[model samples]
Target: MKSKYYIITIVNVITMTIICFYFYEQNKLIEVTTNNDTRPIELLKKIVIDSNDKSAYNELRDAYLNEQYHEEVLFYSLLMANITHYRQAYFDFYYLLKYADRSQEMKIFDNETRLLMIEYLKKGAALKHEQSMHELGDLYMEGKYVPKDTILGKKLINSIGL
Candidate 1:
């Protein structure tokens, strides 16, 4: 009986230690801070350089957006969108459309690019992405690319439980 208790106690200690280590690692990943010695952008850039860390990529995206770095926003947004970060991707595309005038400047915002962007939104919507559904619905309702369909827009918004 004493041996059994000792073994159980040892096992519990090991388990607790493992749990603590796991939480520590997770917290480390999430604890991004701007300190006097390190700028937030520099840390963000380091995180982005690693590239496999999605959370860091998201932080970088937000940072770029806050700074009005349109091109960087587009780049990170596209990356996030491709990886199923649908809402961020949709908003980024929306921002580009609403502000950048990339099409006019580069002579590329023709029918093809518009259609492509619409398709991207549709893909996200198909995945039950809320912003994509909302944006696509709005576009449909406004007849931005296709015929106006208020019903579809309402349905999309409704699906979001909003």
Candidate 2:
């Protein structure tokens, strides 16, 4: 009847809208990947398994180049926090705090990354990472991120050797 037709039409419209929204998000993520020339995390994983693979690197670069603004910002932010690259765990912790949550699925590298950061901080207080020392100093002064330990903060800053 007329009522049934109206309901059907509304359901179809809603379904189409949902589909459109999904594609829009996909395009946005892809656009972000391209603009920054960052490879999608998936592609980056392949390159990790094959360090000398130029093709993988090229794919990564291409994806970044095609990425959108927001995606690039997020990508670079994560890149900066990469423990293997920076080893300054505090920066990663603070940086991740912006977007991370318990419900999020753990990436393959997440555990190792966190462990390395913790180890680096504990062993040498991020000796080569200037920002870590600064953060440590701030944490000591503020007693917010870390326990109040002025002596430890001073020693960490000095250890950075910056």
Which candidate has the top score in lDDT?
1
- Model 1 pairs in collision: 103-109
lDDT (Cα, tens digit) per residue for candidate 1, span 94-118: 5565465554656445554455456
Model 2 misplacement above 4 A: 1-29, 33-45, 48-90, 98-124
Candidate 2, lDDT over the whole model:
0.45
Best by TM-score: 1
Q: What is candidate 2's TM-score against the reference?
A: 0.38
Per-residue C-alpha lDDT of model 2 across residues 76-130, encoded as one tens digit per residue: 3233333234343234333333234333586433433334333334433444556
